[model samples]
Target: MKRVFIIAVAIVTLLVSAEAQKQKVGIVLSGGGALGFGHIGVLQALEDNGIYPTIVAGTSMGALVGAMYANGLRPQDIFDLVKAEEFDKISKIITPSGLRRGSMGISDHKNILDMLDKYIPANDFDSLKMPLYVCVSNISKSQGEIIHSGGRLHEYLLASSSIPLVFEAVELDSMYYVDGGVFNNLPAQAIRDKCTYLIGSNVNPEKYRSPIKSGKDVAMRSVSILIYENTKPGIEMCDFMVDVPVNYFYSPMDFKHFYEIYQIGYKAGLDYIKEHPEIVRKCKGKRPDW
Candidate 1:
């Protein structure tokens, strides 16, 4: 009788452990150019609370941050990289005259790609520390493309962030690809099937106020409007959402205010975690190995 009771207790413990392991958590990051820095802060908050994602999906700037994080970079590591002077040089826009004649825009896409190659340790999907889904706008198909495997990881990351008319499109397998924001700025749906729970970080401003100023403002506001409309479905999919507070003044091209933007995201993340303790409880089941 004693032996049977011990065996039953051991079996129950094993079943509980297996159930915990089965809970897969995913985080979806949205595209917001320079504002994407905020995602790092949110990631840090999640890490601090012992919550780690089993999968990560992102579009545009979100793709850059999410890929780096999923590739084993800590939030602080990414923050330090972006705050350095080297990143400024890499992210700089080429002068119009320096651009190839009749090119789409002034950004030197090669510089960003080179930076990614140097920083990201993995060259392909099979080696990534965790599963990552990068979203890109497929110009040939006129839709969003979710890249989970194949090809160089850095190149795909660049393709996901290649802002139309600002940076040249990336050609892979004869298909032209650009910023995923053009289609799905918030791509929670890409990883919905892969995880049982979802968390999302949105840095795009809810709405642009009046008194639109420069051409840059117009461009930012126009894109923000589209992101606002498109993000609704993705927002609905998230079990927990961290809406990073940002305004129209935060230009996508501006990389100078890293601390400010990151802090905002961190606060928002902490606030959400505090308000929804259940999310933390659910996520505690699976901690990232890295």
Candidate 2:
């Protein structure tokens, strides 16, 4: 555990170093727009489907956030104000221009992943296991633009939990976010990239690993659950891969914590990718030949 933590930190530190070496992009704001980058996985997905960002996208922001938190910011410092519904306080701490500018709305996190291709391939794009009612109730009662600000708020919560958030995990939240409706459906554009899906009722026979074609390492049933140990080739039969522990998803954290774990894993994956772009390409491709 200690070694894993150390390695994760080291990777993040290296990514930050690389990011700092590059010149910062110009902030094209509407007089006071605090800029943020899109998630890398989302970017890869977009590229896979022939979609790319117009102005640097969110990948840069996700990378920068990873670098910043791993180096400059502390989980406690950002969260104290956020839990108090002080979005500005959290943003001010991270954003030099004193705002989130634009986030999780017009340029949401998941939309980015659904558009790109990850070279490494991942099973992180599965359904979410959050408590629907609590999330919606919180969204309705919350004091902000429920879509954008609320999304950012969830991000704050994720950061506070010491879990790194990423584009892929954020994508899962669009359908499974705390406030996301249970019976409600996603918008037309949102599910556009779901070109293919698989279903297998009995995967217990051990020879049924098929649906999931992307070969990946380290999969999770959710934020608190570990589906397979690092690099274990999960079962595959037809259109879906099998072998992740279902109990992992049942362990229970509010929708917020689930998102946090997703963030942590996604962030780790992205950091690994930024420092390892080749890996992202394969993962985002969905069904890689490798």
Candidate 3:
């Protein structure tokens, strides 16, 4: 009996060690306009604590920040850039004049394309240190058809972030691309089986009250860590937006509110990392081997 107990303990130890060693991580970002901006703080906290993901998949605004971060840009830098910019500039991008009669009208496609040209120009995503899976829903196709790749990256980001009625559907490769969030706000599908661990930062509030509804929904269900507001304890998830208001995009930006919201996400991420032994074992300076 003693010998059997000893062997069982050894097996458990070995299993834990193997699990610790296989820590390739993936991050999923959900869309929610200015509210989605909170993901920046969560991402910064992850990196600050050494929880780097091997792959990142994002929808809408989450894609904007996630792709930028994957390309080596810092969260604060992205924030600063947004802060310095004028609201009028955003208003210009969303101007109704940019849209014309079509299946999906009322778009800011042209202005947004111009902005993309001026800011994040054409780039080969494969050149980045980490792989970035961009999420986009096809507006011209049957319900639930998604385009995960195939075109200029700028086009992907712009299309994924373009909110219907707010930002117009983007025309690319002869197809109209709209926000990926329409079909799957939590675009964890992009990660699929590509990594050992997945961390999904969901900005949408409806998931708290609804069941997983789409392919993206099922993908989010598979993530190792899902961060959202008012979320009940699940397989493995965190709730940080509990106090933050759900309606953030249409509302005007107040620096105080933005800072508060940012800190809410940051602290939530920081605390989660600090509490997880599996994550803390491989701190920032000591990244797990790929």
Alpha-carbon TM-score of each model against the true structure: 0.85, 0.18, 0.68
Q: How far is 252's C-alpha from truth in model 3 (Å)?
A: 10
Worst 10-residue lDDT window for candidate 1 reads: 89-98
In candidate 1, residue 244 scores what lDDT?
84
For residues 13-55, what per-residue lDDT tens digits would candidate 3 score against the true structure? 9987876664377777776666666777787787787767666
The better candidate by TM-score, 1 or 3, is: 1
lDDT, residue 209, model 1: 42
C-alpha lDDT (0 to 100) for residue 106 of candidate 3:
64
> What's the C-alpha lDDT at position 105 in model 1?
61
Q: Which numbered prediction scores highest in TM-score against the true structure?
A: 1
Q: Is candidate 1 or candidate 2 better by lDDT?
A: 1
Error of 3 at 61 (Å): 0.8
Candidate 2, after superposition: displacement of residue 57 in Å? 17
Q: Count of backbone clashes for each model?
A: 0, 47, 3
Measured on C-alpha atoms, candidate 2 has an lDDT of 0.24
